[model samples]
Each structure stands twice: as C-alpha cells, then as structure tokens.
Target: MRILWTTLLMACAAACTQPANKSVPETIEPDEAHIALAETLTPADPTLAPIYDRSCRACHALDGLGAPLTGHAAAWAPRLEERGMEGLLGSIHAGRGAMPSMGYCADCTDDNFRALIEFMSTEGQS
Candidate 1:
C-alpha cells in the first residue's frame, strides 16, 4: 500500500538523520604547565615528528577538546589499558568522537601510528 511505503520511508529518513547536538564526553581543563609541556613535546623520531605535528598535535596537545593531553600519562593510561595498541589503532582508523579517520594522516602506516601512540602516551617525553 502507498501509506505503508510512505511510513517506511519516513521512518528510514528519521533514523538516518543525525541529531544537531551530539553529546560529548567531559573534557578536563588543562593548566598552563600542561599546555606548555604539551606544546613543546614532539616524537623523538624525525619522520614521526612531522606526522604528529600535522595530524595529532592540534587536538592531543590541548585539553578541553575531549582528547588526552600529550605527556599526561594519567589521562592516556586508562585508554591505553582498556584498548591495547591494536585497539587504539582501530580507534584512530575509525575516528573516535571529534578525531577524524586515520587521525587526519592519510599516509600513515601502522608502524607510524604505533610510534605516535607511544610518544603521546608516555609521560616523560621532551
């Protein structure tokens, strides 16, 4: 029946539409020291540094973006523990929350992602 088809189409359309306001996770307020430290930190690897600067730094280094700050082991600890390297890589590939797919690094290989994760998760990196 025409009415039945219309109802099905309407339901499908409604289901496909995304809500205007998406609920975001609570973000921590970063202190000046944390901001300064995050800004200064970079991956030790020369190849990875550029990739990090271009892709990950913008969100990961700052707080209030729902991303863990660089050099903040506590923030990253739970994530690392819950999702191991492979799981974390899956998040990056799938794009979690505000982060874009491949973490905005289309050219990055698995090894590159692993290195970047290690650098960001570690506490004492210059």
Candidate 2:
C-alpha cells in the first residue's frame, strides 16, 4: 500500500511538471531586402515619431534581434494572430522575449502604444 501511494504521488508529480504545449510559429527569416525596408518604416503621425524613435526603432529595425522588424508583415502576422492587439499591449506592458517593459517608453500612453503598433505593423506591407 505504501509503495502504491508513492508510485501514485510520483506519477502525479511528473504530470504536473510536464511542459505546456509550445505553439509558437516559425519566424520568417529576415532578408536583406526586409532589413533595408525596415529602416524606412517610420510612423507617419508626427506625434508618434518621437516615441517610436526613442523606444522601438533600435531593435525593430535590425534583424536577428528577436524583435519583429518594423514593417515586416510576415514577421508580425503570426504574432498578431496569436496575441491580438490587447495581448501585444500586455506583452509590451510586461515585457516579453527580448523586449523591455512598456517597450522602454516611460511616459507613453496607451494610445501611443496602439499607434506605434499600427505604424510598425502596416508600413512594411509589400
């Protein structure tokens, strides 16, 4: 009876410790074309430019930085599908992967974050 109880406990512990399903999609590789194009992706709204330049431009413009490059639709599509705008906002607020919390924008409002997302997600459309 004691051995049976120990075995049951071990089984339960193993089940509880199993890793959750990893559903991440394959990231699209950034080509030279995409990287150069990312450089040209800037927020059309003048008000959002400073915020983007200050917070998002550095990492998002470069490839292999673990950031979805600004204006790379292929890179951003799966993320958008999985996370939606709200989830993206939450990730930004909490910082996920290589991104820092609030994307390092100390003074940005929610509206500003939305606008930046829109600009980056759309401007790269081919």
Candidate 3:
C-alpha cells in the first residue's frame, strides 16, 4: 500500500515537471522570423517615406516596443479587424497604449495620417 502510494506520488511529480505543450494554433500567424524581418522594412511609397521616418518608424518598424511591427500582416490584420480604420485613426489622434497622440507627427494632417497608416499596414505585400 505504501509502495503504491509512493509510485503514484512519483508519477504526479514527473507529470508536473514536464514541459508544457505549446500546441500550434489552427491559424498560424506570422512567426518571429517574419516579424524580425518586417522590422527592417519601411513603406515603399515616396510620399509616405518622410512621414514614416519622422513618426511611425521608431515604434512600428522596430522591436522591443509595444507598437506592432510593420509589414507583418498577421499582426496588423487582427488590429485592423478589432479597430477599424476609423478606430485606428481615433487611436492615433488620441494615442493608444505606448503610442502618443498623432504618433508624434506634429505637422501631419489627417490625410497624411491615413496614408501613413495604409503604407505601414501594407508594407510587405505585392
């Protein structure tokens, strides 16, 4: 009886010490490698270039910041879904989380902001 109890305790300990299974998601989002690659890309649009360099590039194009890395469609898609274009604009206007109002584009107009968003959100695709 004591041996049976001891064996059960050992089994429980082993199970508890096992590493967790990180099951894959049904929809595979972009992996870290993609995200890392995206971090180095900027908008291709010439008009939006300065705007991005001045404001969006610091956070969106870089890692270690809460802002979503640019060019990663998987990351940006959900955000777009949750907060439509209007919501994104409002967030940009009022700032969201680590982002500041107007995303630090002190001179950018709403139209410019929209273009910048479009450019950043659609960086990698053809």
Error of 2 at 67 (Å): 0.4
User: Which residue pairs in model 1 clash with each other?
Assistant: none
lDDT of 1 by residue, 1-108 (tens): 544643553454346444322232134345567778898898888999999999999999876788888886555645654566888999999999999999889999
Residue runs of model 2 more than 4 Å from their true location after superposition: 1-26, 123-126
Question: Better model by TM-score, 2 or 3?
Answer: 2
The lDDT, on a scale of 0 to 1, for candidate 2 is 0.74
List the candidate numbers ranked by lDDT, top first. Answer: 1, 2, 3
lDDT of 2 by residue, 1-126 (tens): 544643553454346443332343436566777789998777777888888888899999888888988887666655666677887888899999888898989899998988888778763642
- TM per candidate: 0.74, 0.77, 0.68
Candidates sorted by TM-score, best first? 2, 1, 3
Q: Indicate the worst ten consecutive residues by lDDT in candidate 1.
A: 19-28
For candidate 3, give the lDDT of residue 50.
76
- lDDT comparison, 1 vs 3, better candidate: 1
By lDDT, the best candidate is: 1
lDDT of 1 at 29: 47
